[model samples]
Target: MGVTIAIDCMGGDHGPAVTVPAALSFLRSHADANVILVGREEAIQPLLGTAQSEFGARLKLRPASEVVTMDDPPAIAMRTKKDSSMRVVMDLVKAGEANAAVSAGNTGALMAISRFVLKTLPGVDRPAIATVLPSMRGHTYVLDLGANVDCSAEHLLQFGVMGSSLVAAIEHKERPSVGLLNIGEEAIKGNDVVKEAADLLRASGLNFYGNVEGDDIYEGTVDVVVCDGFVGNVALKTSEGLAQMLGAMLKEEFSRSLLTKLMAAVALPVLKRFKQRVDHRLYNGAPLLGLRGVVLKSHGSADVLAFSTALARAAEAASNRLIERISERMASMNEVKA
Candidate 1:
C-alpha cells in the first residue's frame, strides 16, 4: 500500500517556502506516496500554485491556523497551540488519515505534541530520536539524538530495541548488532548508569556488541549506537562543527597560493565526490522512534534537498510497517524481562 505523509508546512526556518517545494519534489520522486500539507490556507495556497492540478488527490492541504515556531516551548505547543501545524500533523497520524508525519519545527515542541497525541508504543517508556549517520559500513543508526537528556539504564535498553527494530525494517537486517556509546570499550568504563545499561544490553535479547567509543560510531563498529540524549546531541553537533571546519580549512588552503590553486583544480573531481559521499543532506530524516505512529523530524535549518530527503524516509518507514516491527520487538523484549 502507498504511504500518505502529513507535513507541517508552516513549521520550520523557511516555513512553506521550502517545505511545499520539497513536498512536491518528494511526490514526483515517490510515485506511490501522497502528501498532506498542513498549514494556513492563505499562506500555502500561493506556493502550491498548480500542485493541486499536478498531484490531484495525492497532494492535499489540511489547513491549520497556528504555527509552532522554533522558539516555542513544549508546554506552549501542547497547551496553547491546539490548531498548530505541528499538532495537526500529529492528529492526522493518530486518526490514521496519514500513515506518517514529518516536521522541521521546534524539536522539543514536536516531541511533546507527538507523544501527547499518539502516546508511546506499549513497553516504551520514552520516545527517542534515531538518526542515521554516515559511516564506514555505509551508515549507523544513533539514538536518542536530543530527546531524554537524563535517561535511565532501562531507557538505554529500550533505545537499543527500537534502534534494532528500525534497522531491521529499513535494511531488513534480521539481527542488527547494537552498541552502547560510552567513554571506553571496556566493561569497567563509564558511570553507574551506563555500566548498568551495558549489563542489561548483554542480557537483553538484542544482538548486543558491547561498549563502543565515540570513534567507533564512524568506524561502523555496530549497526546501532545507543546513548542518552545529552551525549548524543553533543556528539552530533560536534561532528557537524568539525565537518564544517574541515571544509572551510580545505577551501582556505586551496585558495592561499597559485601552486595550491592549481593542485585544487586537479583534485576538484575527487573533492566533489568526497563531498557527495559525506553530504549530511542525503541523510536528513530522523524518526522519533517508540511512538505509536510514525513521525520523522527534518533538520530545522534544512534546505529543499534536506526536507525532501526527510519526506522520502517518512514514506519508506510508513509503508514498511516500522511501527509494527517496533511493537513486535518491544513485546518480545518485554516477554524476556518477564
Candidate 2:
C-alpha cells in the first residue's frame, strides 16, 4: 500500500475552504498516496463533492468533532479536546494508519499532541520544529522554531544532527553541512548553553561548520542552522516580517510614478520570480523532529498552495525515513553514550 497522510481538516484560519481543497489537490497529484481527512463529516463531505468517485477509495474522511483553538493552552487542549482534529489525526499516525500528519492550527497544541501521541524516537531528547525559509541560494533550514524554548547543550547537538539529516532528505544533498546559530561567527560568542553546545558540536565529530551569524541564514552558507527555540523563533519571525515589509515597500514604490509603473511592468516578471523566491509561504510547513512519524506544522494563514506543498513534503519525509535515520545517527553519537 502507498503512504497514507492524515490531515487535520478543521485546522488553519481559513478552515475547510483551504484545508479541504489542499487535501483534494494532494489526492489529485499523488495517486499512490491516500488522504485520511479528519474533521466534522458534514463540513468535509461537501468539499469532497461527487467527483470523489474519480479518486476511488484513495480519499477517505475520518470525522473529528472539535478543533483546538489558537489561543487555547496546549496542555488544556491536549487534555480536554480529545476529539479535536489535531489530536485525532496525530492518533492516526501513532496507530500506523498514516505515515504523517499535517496541521495549520495552534503550534503548541500540535507539538503537544504530537509528542503525547507519537512520542519521541529512540535517542531523541526532544523534538525540534524546523521550518524551511526561502533563500537566494535555493532554501535554508532553521530549527527549534518554538517547538522548544529552552534547550540543553545535548539537545542542541541532537538538533544539529536531526536538522542536517532533514536537509539532506529535502534538498537531495548527501551529508549537508550544518551550522550553529550565534550572534557572531566566533566560537566564543553567546551564553553558556550556546558556548557549551558549540563545543559539543565541534567535538562530536559531526559535519559541523562552526558558528554562523543570523545574516548567514538567508545567505545559505550551510544546509542547516541550529539554535534554541528562543533564538530560532525570533530569527524566523524577523525574516518573515522583513520579507512582508519589503514586499509592501516595493509595491508602493512601483505605484509612485507613471515611469516606475511602466518600468515595473517590464521588470514585473523577473520581480515576480524574485518575490516568489523569498515568500515564506512558498516553504510554509516544517517537520517536528523526534516524533515517531512525521508531523508538519503549516502556518495558520497558509493557502491551498502552501498546504499542497506541505503534503508533498510529508511524502518526501515518509519515503526517506527521516525519523529512523535520525534515530540511527543519534544512537551512534559518541558524546551521547559517553
Leading candidate by lDDT: 1
Give the residue spans of candidate 1 off by over 4 A: 185-188
Could you tell me how far off, in angstroms, the CA of residue 333 lies in candidate 1 after the best superposition? 1.5
Candidate 2 per-residue lDDT over residues 1-338, each given as its tens digit:
78899999988899888998998888888879988989988988988786479777888889999989999899999999999999999999988889999999999899889999988987787899998876668677989898778899999998998998897777778788889998863665688988899998997767899889998888888888999998999998887788788889999999999999999999989998987766666687789998888999998999999998898899889888887777777777854567
How does residue 313 of candidate 2 score in lDDT? 91
Per-model TM-score versus the true fold? 0.97, 0.95
How many angstroms is residue 149 displaced in model 1 relative to the true structure, after the best TM-score fit?
1.0
Tens digits of per-residue lDDT, candidate 1, 1-338, equal 48999999997789999999999999999988899999999998999879899999998999999999878889987999999999999999999999999999999999999999999999999999999999997789999998999999999999999999999888888899999999964566799999899999999989999999999999999999999999999999999999999999999999999999999999999999999999999999899999999999999889999999999999888888899999998898788778
Whole-model lDDT values for every prediction: 0.94, 0.87
Candidate 1 whole-model C-alpha lDDT, 0 to 1: 0.94
For model 1, name the residue pairs that clash: none
